[model samples]
Target: MTDPTYEFSRAITRRPAASITDGLRAEDIGTPDLGRMLASHAHYVETLKKTGAEVIELAPLESYPDAVFVEDTTLCLPQGAVMMRPGAPSRMGEVAEMEPTIRGVYDEVRQIAGPGHIEGGDILVTGREILVGRSDRTDAAGVTELTEIVSDWGHTVREVFTPPGVLHFKTDCSLLDGETILSTKRLDASGCFEGYRVLHVAEGEEAAANSIRFNQFVLAPAGFPRTTEMLRQNGYDVVEIDNVECAKLDGGMSCLSLRF
Candidate 1:
């Protein structure tokens, strides 16, 4: 009865490269400082290691500015790993770059061979089912392909909707445990998490919804005090890491790594 959703034995992360300043973003908030991003990434990896999980840190790919966001490349499940087809043309190469590492860890590695596109960020695996959000990055054809692939492995895929202007489905919510979820008010209002126990981040701290529950700790982005206190009061061991630099590139706690 182990929950692969939160309890993971291994994780994969990539160090931020000097070219992270060129990473894609919805807006040009500012360029990410490589030094700061490196320090924060180290803290993130260290936190994962403290959970007793082997953290495989990959070398940076200078040619791909968004390569540090390894989560967008693949979806790791207990049954197998699925390589994603990123809709962002610049990010498509990241899947190939990640295949070798994924194959090294999982014997069964499937891929979304598609004229349609899907990014791992748009998919969420829960205890009951797999929720695939239809975003700019993930389309019907992509979701259909994913459903066909995972159905063979005894998993159900449910198509959902990502709010307008959101970068990814997970940008507004995260699974806290087997049945509980930490989400934003706006997303919860959509009844996307109807059957699960939902906890909303305090108003105006929507970014906090991107936190991840790994083993015994919830790695969350720093600067969201109300959300942090809320999670702690709800009995989660929250580890706040500096996310300023990552956020500049539209990255968050869950975006920085792929856990399994």
Candidate 2:
């Protein structure tokens, strides 16, 4: 069966703002080098293109320091594009800035109202259902609102509690195919993916769980040799790229683009 999660032909990404150091971070992991970040981002865009995805690169929004994490701004589904309400108040405006671009591509654009903050990172869409994590960044209200919106589109929404210390649900898991999941050992222990085939990220490389299985290739974060080898062994055509700079800001390969 075809995996709905990896059936993306178009993708949207934003350039990292020059003031990225001012962006939000869960931990003070040293400032990222802007020059290296830019180079890495360029390589990321090229990788997406090489995978046959039509990449839409948006200019940097200098005012929004964390604008580079574009995946948090919206969720692009086959039905339409939903403008998300970021959990972080500082990152909220990034949604409005992204609205126009999203509207230009998708005819059915939806928005999540306040009293409910839903970031895309907390959502994972599989072929049969959509999983929304109940995390600090995504609350019950948000999941409720999201459920109401997508249920009409023929999708069942499953709510999962994000484990403590995980920034987003995807921070510990990713959909590799319709029935397979690439996840951290911590999340797998939660039993959220009990029915799916769970492929654990290599020990000490927990960050590798946040990968993107786009079309025919898996865009994995570079430097996680063990995890990369594991994916390859599983028969995936993996393409690893450096995302260390973005990782400093709690980003991963999946965070760089909103694909649909």
Candidate 3:
């Protein structure tokens, strides 16, 4: 067994010294919004580091001021990164700004041309298979394109549909390590997600359930005590942190950064 090391002291800097790209624009959220967003961003960055994975920060777009811009979405993963064609038209520019930065992180990066639309939020990597949601942000064509790309990289891609109530699959689902899964109870997926069993979280706790699995670690917001307990009950050492500021602006722990 590994040493607990006093649970988790503030030994590591949770805040990121690096900033996002200049192309990222958070104007729809405004100045006060930026402050709140960055506070969560800092906490989010620190969590990524603890996952034992390396992280790269993207600069905000100075011109596109309204991009709810976060680098993780733009920096799509496993092997070569792919820039998404955002579901929200306002966020489309993020694809371009994110491409080069992601390439800087990985040697090979690809793009999904239109006639197909996809959101970064739709990606969930379960072992060697990648599940992409066929949402308004992502179409069947986009899934086909991604399927080919990932298959070329020696990974499998599966397509799932986002139910009406949920915003996106990732907003309600995530891969926990290689076995367990944290998903918002109902998304209407029957056999689309194969190869492994699933664990579901109720809809009421959707926000808490939709967290990113960094390296092998899970992070949570402070407000949901029940959800926190639920994760712990399932044998996950969840690291809770304050993210009230970003939460108000629709930012969850998963929205913070990308882990490759």
Best candidate according to TM-score = 1
Residue 4, model 1: Cα distance from true site in angstroms: 0.9
Candidate 3 has its poorest 10 consecutive residues by lDDT at: 3-12
Best candidate per lDDT, number? 1
lDDT of 1 by residue, 38-111 (tens): 99999999999999999999999999999999999999999899999999999999999999999999999999
Q: How far is 27's C-alpha from truth in model 1 (Å)? A: 0.7
- Per-residue lDDT, model 2, residue 17, is 81
- On the 0 to 100 scale, the lDDT of residue 197 in model 3 is 62
Error of 1 at 97 (Å): 0.4
lDDT (10s digit) by residue, model 2, range 139-246: 888999888888777779999988898899999999888789999999999899978899999999999999998888898989999999999999998988888888
lDDT of 3 by residue, 78-197 (tens): 456777777667667766766655666677878777667777677777655677777656788877877777788888787888766455567676666665577766652555555666
Clashes counted in candidate 2 amount to: 0
Which pairs of residues clash in candidate 2, taking residues 3 or more apart in a chain or in different chains?
none
lDDT: worst 10-residue window of model 1:
115-124
